[model samples]
Target: MSSQKASRKAKKKQGGKQRAQRATSNVFSMFDQSQIQEFKEAFTMIDANRDGFVDLDDLKDTYASLGTDPEETILQAFKVLDPDNKGVLHKDYLADMMQTQADRFSRDEVLQMFNISPIDAAGNLDYKSLCYIVTHGQEEEQA
Candidate 1:
């Protein structure tokens, strides 16, 4: 084959792979209302002060409820997502964490799957909204 033809073929192959990956990732994705409710409940439980934010202490408490006693893991997880490190988790931070955890989907894809509305009409997400998207979701459906 000519060089031009070979280059075109390679590009087409790469594009095909990208499309296939997206399709595969989206095949089992969905979000339900109950999942949203569950996330809200979990967030409420973690936000002991009802300040609409969850601090490290609140996170520790939440993990304890989940039977996970990884102080280091929890701390690391928090550090990874807590850009401001205010020790309090905002909704958008939580959503980013959730997207990281999902692994199969990109952050944007995960947001879309959860039906999260944009923040301030700028097409971004806030802490609370991100929290809801990350926390809400059925395990079986995720599988």
Candidate 2:
């Protein structure tokens, strides 16, 4: 084949690159209402005891069923997600966790989060900000 044909083939194989998406403030806003309702239904399934909340055991069960570990990472996440330390994960917090926990922070998101907290221009985050970031969802407004 001629070099020109090979070049065309290479170009076709390269395909188009996707642009990076902006972080949405309201995570559920991206989904259609039916999809959102389905998410709630899935949460209900995870609640196991029908106690209107999911505890660590429920989380472990779901994780195990999905062939993943119910290990430290998830434990720490639950600690962070269950800010009130109620030992039960409710639907609202579940939604907030889905909104906040799972995402790898984009640079813009990091900046936004940092800006909201007690970080100064010199790149120091005070204890309050650190505490806030730990207890509340990353994208949640000042608590």
Candidate 3:
């Protein structure tokens, strides 16, 4: 009974981990490692107080250090952020937007370009399919 209970608990933990990974896989998977690192650095810069999230207080502190209040125009620039109207800007959202908007080939575009699965079972790009796409400039259905 004890061993069975332990096995069930382990399975639950693994399932929870998989769910967490799936939840975040689309957050910034469009970016390469270097781009993700750069975004992390930029987020750190904007966070101001070393807190995990960015809010009005962080921006005010940044402007205060510059010896001036932020202009209305400057504030307007951030209005597009916080898409959920959450008031706080999350680092993940910042990275996702940057990757999606700045990339010439967005994730959705790439996924649509191939009839074959672009992503392998491991959730990374299927390099074999990618090479085929690059060489042929079109998808060839696999058997």
Candidate 4:
């Protein structure tokens, strides 16, 4: 009976690992060169001043363009997402923030830009997860 129990536990562990691998694979499949280009373009558009960074004003403009109101709460969320404390957001930072906020997300929620996901059991995001989200919406029409 003990041996059977051990086998079951091992199988469960293997299954968990497999799930993680699948999630990672799915995430990586989403990130292609074109996706990177799209992100760059989007970032450029957000940074209207061409200042190489997205400040609060730029974020507000982006929100407005999306037909969303940039309320104080939203602004605070942006600030929380901006890790560099440069008062501006980089493309990578935005991507990370978006992915981290997605559904089943284990990471801390910042802006309401993402839906939390449990795809990755780890609290932090792996590269593939980040790549997947950054490329998500843009892929369908571009391809």
Most lDDT-accurate candidate: 1
Summed backbone clashes in each candidate are: 5, 0, 0, 12
What residue runs in model 4 are displaced by over 4 Å at the alpha carbon? Answer: 19-28, 50-53, 63-143
Worst 10 residues of 1 by lDDT: 130-139
Instruction: Choose the strongest candidate by TM-score.
Output: 4
Worst 10 residues of 4 by lDDT: 116-125
Candidate 1 regions exceeding 4 Å error are 2-29, 60-143
Q: List the residue pairs that clash in candidate 2.
A: none
Q: Residue 3 of model 4: what lDDT? A: 100
**Per-residue error at 27 for model 4, in Å?**
3.6
Residue 79 in candidate 3, Cα distance off native in Å: 17
lDDT of 1 at 33: 73
Of the two candidates 2 and 3, the one with more favorable TM-score, higher being better, is 3
Residue 108 error, candidate 4, Å? 14
Cα lDDT of model 3 by residue, 1-143, tens digit: 99999999999999999999888788677899999999999788879989799987777677677786555433344346634443334433443554577544565655454344355454443333444444345654599
Error of 3 at 99 (Å): 29
The true-versus-predicted C-alpha distance at residue 57 of model 2, in Å, is 1.1
Write the residue-wise lDDT of candidate 4 on 32-108 in tens digits: 98998898898899997789999867876887788876454445565666555444454345556566665543334
Q: Rank the candidates by TM-score, best first.
A: 4, 3, 2, 1
Q: Give the candidate order by descending lDDT.
A: 1, 3, 2, 4
lDDT of 2 by residue, 55-107 (tens): 86777678777887645444566566557664445433344445566675555
